[model samples]
Target chain A: MTDTITIDDHQVPFEAGQTIMEAARAAGLYIEHLCYNPAYQPHGSCKLCSVKVDGVIQTACTMPAIAGQKVESDSPEMKSRRKTLVEMIFAEGNHYCAFCIKSGSCDLQALAYHLDMHENSFNHRYPVRVIDASHPDLILDHDRCIFCGLCIRASRDQDHKNVFTMAGRGKATRLAVNSETGKLGDSTIAADDAAAHVCPVGAIMPRRGAYSTPIGERYFDARGIDEIDNASGKL
Target chain B: MRSTTPQGNCDVIQREPGQKIRIASCSLAGCFGCHMSMLDIDELVVEVVHHLEYCRGPLNDVRELRDVDVGVVEGALCNEDNVKVLEQFRANCDLLVAVGACAINGGLPAMRNHFGLTACLKEAYLDAEGVVNPEIPRDAELPRLLNRVRPIQEVVKVDYFLPGCPPPAAAFTELFTALIEGREPAFDEDMVRFD
Candidate 1:
């Protein structure tokens, strides 16, 4: 018999090693998340995917799928908690979505839309971050980063370049390059590397690649993130 | 209804009776796109007109800002004029609404916060690839620019914020409807489209 788990009352079938995120995605269910990728081990960093697992709050990305396990998602309380977490992300970074190249298709922007974020209710940190334009093919705008560690994990875990790491902690934490110079151009992050593309926001995007797709024609334009590839963990 | 032109019976303009919600709108250091989005309400603008009267705005040439029920300010607070306008909104209206990303968090105009005001002017007039007397414009006629572009909330107490470059038209409709009905303007996920 196929082992199945219940997520938000939907019976999701999973393999032996599948996490709740993977099972939900396999069943075409959308569990809001940011940092858990299927290509690598699940890392619960964003916490936007936090759901009630057997009546306790647990990250769906990290929780292993147990047959008949009850997972509660999409509740009003869950949405409120998720909204708070997303609000914190907006507060942490100066996410100017208006002029951003990744404005239409950005996952963070899409998620913000999904969460009905009409205002950045939290105090705006307005951290003056650097816009690194040194890379030949890519640009890194640290202003919009939420420090989800997707690039950090993807760099070391999948690309094997060890090109990204999180330096500092708490509010001062920032995404850093692996090279001695600490610049993206100085690091081994190529334009096509998995690390380069794992950024959920506009922090990492190809140079001059923005606005190529018009406002209404981008990836997340007409359809939400759930419809397009599950957007599961930058995978 | 108010503003209705009486036919040949009389030359009098019969205005709407009773208490109509007063609205005041302004565009600060912005592209005036939000106002355009406001107009994008299409035929539904008639509904807004039915409920509210324009006390002061670009939609009409009304100059004086009376006691308004709602103040809609669009764009970032960049120069002295912008500040004056924002303060006027606060003093004139009971509820102040920041209508776009620019008003909420500085938006595109606030991109100059990174380069500083001096560098921004120099880059535009002096450094850009151009040939001429590339000098920054300085005159008493122009409003004095602030050190950094600031969001409207930083300058005044904003009651609500509608996020977007210029926010969608539907968002404005929802907010207007909610405000007209004396309910809180809370956007659901389906109504949020930042682009």
Candidate 2:
């Protein structure tokens, strides 16, 4: 008998060491998330994937899947909470989606659309951040960084370059380059590095290729994130 | 129906049977792209006109903002005049709808929020390449610039928000048709976009 967990009334089978997120993804169920990419170790920083497991709230990416356990997601309460989390992320960063290069393909923007976040409920923090265009091929616009640390993990674990790191503490925490000058140009990150491609927002982007794909042809333009995620079967 | 007075007092305004819904619109610190999109409703304008009475919008030249059923606002509040106009719309209209991305999240104009007001003014006026005579305008008649550009919702209560760069004409059609037919307005997934 397979160990199966019920998520939003859907039976999702899981292996012994699998988390609820992995189980749900394998079952072709889409759970909204930002910091829980399957390419690296799950980091439950975003809290957008908070689910009710046996009537208790827990992060789906970190919570272990158990047989006969019922997880509550896709409910109105859960959706609303996820929307508020997205709104807070928008409020914290200077995400002007109107002109952002990653407006269409951005995971944060796509999740916002998927969660039906129409207006930001929180006041805009408008934190003053830097835009590092020092790299020959990449531009780091810190204004849009959500601090998911996907780049840090990808660089350290996958690329073995250690090009990125999370510096400071609390609200003052920021993405820092591992170089003497504290600039991306001085770092060993390449344009093809996994760290360069793992940014979920517009914070890290390759230069000279913006808006290459027209508005209607972009990802998330024709399909919602849920549909795309289900079709791709990736976490 | 109920309306708010300029003094911020609620007043009952009786609407006669078979009366058309009145609408007013304004553009502040944004481009008139949203108004252009509203106009792109094209042939549907004839049908819309039958149900709505234009009071003070780009379609009409009326300067005074009269009591209206819906007040559509486009753009962010970047100056004192924009703030005054938004307050006036809030006072006069029963339902205030933020029309586009500018009114909802400050859009492109709010990009100035990163640089301080002095820096922006200096860049535009004093540091530009074309320097015949660079001087920051400080005329008494000119509306005083706010320290930061803000979305309309930051200044007044907004009942509805139509998100997009300039919300697609289909979105307007949906909203207006729903309003005219006395149905609750809800956007399709494709209709709501930040860009």
Candidate 3:
């Protein structure tokens, strides 16, 4: 008999070593996350997937699924907490969705809409950051980066380029390039690398064919993030 | 102008027995696109006028805001004059609604927040490619600019916020219809958009 875990009252069977996020996702449940891509190792940085397990708060992506565990993810309290997390992400960066090419397709924007986040409750930081446009094919706009480390993991683990790394600490932490010149243009990352296409926001963008698709006709325009994720069976 | 019969019968709209709901709207440091979207509510404006009185707005050309039931504000606070206008709206109106991305999060204009105010003024007046007379304009008539552009809620309490580049006309129509009926406005999934 397969051991089962309950996520929001739905029973999900999980194999040994599978995380709660994996189990929940396999059961066709959406837990609302940003940093927990299935292709990479679980990164618990973005706490948008924080859920209560047995009445204690835990990150669903990193926590191992145990038999008879009760996970509460879609409760009112969890939704409110997720809203605050999303708001902090917005306020921490200069996210001007109006003009961004990634407006309709960006996960951050889609999550905000999904959570019904009308206004950012916190004060805007408006931090000044470098826009690294020296790269021939890629433009790394640091302002939109949420520091999720997806690019870092993709470049290091998949592409074997080790081109991206996080530098500094706390509010001063930033995505730094691995070249001696400390610039993306001087790095070995290629345009076709998984790192180039893995960013959830507008931080890393290819220079060519940016505006080929109109804003209203893009990914999240026709369906909410949850609906799309459910239908596609991927985050 | 007064008309007893509405252009089209709207069963959802209901007004107080004797008093018409007074409304005021303004555009601060914005492009007035939110106001344009409000106008894009189209023929619904005909029904809106029957139950709501335009005390101060682009529709009525009234300068003073006083004793209004609702105040619709667009744009962020970029200058001293904009702040004063927002304060006036908050003081005179019972309910204040932020109508767009600019009013809620500083939108496109807030992009300048990354660059300091001094750099912005200098770049515009002196460092730009075409500059015959390089002088930062300073007159008592001109309102002083704030150090950073901010949403209206930062300066005053906002009862509601409709988020969009300019919230779709359907969002405004729903909000107005709900308010006129004395019910809380509920936006559909498609009605709330960031871009």
**Better candidate by lDDT, 2 or 3:** 3
DockQ winner, 1 or 3: 3
lDDT of 2 by residue, A149-225 (tens): 88998999999999999999988989999999999999999988989888888899989889787888887788887
i-RMS for every candidate (Å) is: 10.3, 6.1, 10.7
How far does residue A170 in candidate 2 sit from its true spot (Å)? 2.8
For lDDT, candidate 1 versus 2, the one ahead is 2
lDDT of 3 by residue, A1-235 (tens): 9999989979999999999999988888999988878889989999999999999999999999999999999999999899889999999998999888788888888899898888888888889998999899999999999999999999999999999999999999999999999999999998889999899888999897676777667878888877765211111
lDDT of candidate 1 over A16-112, digit per residue (tens): 9888888898888888887766776778989999999999999999988988899998889998799779878876788887777777667787877
Please give the CA lDDT of all the candidate structures: 0.78, 0.85, 0.86
DockQ of each: 0.30, 0.44, 0.43
User: TM-score, each model?
Assistant: 0.82, 0.94, 0.94
DockQ of 3: 0.43
Error of 1 at A14 (Å): 4.0
Every model: Cα RMSD to truth: 7.4, 4.1, 5.8
Q: By the DockQ metric, which is better: model 1 or model 2? A: 2
Question: Candidate 1: misplaced stretches above 4 Å?
Answer: A1-5, A11-13, A229-235, B1-19, B45-50, B61-63, B79-84, B116-148, B154-160, B173-191
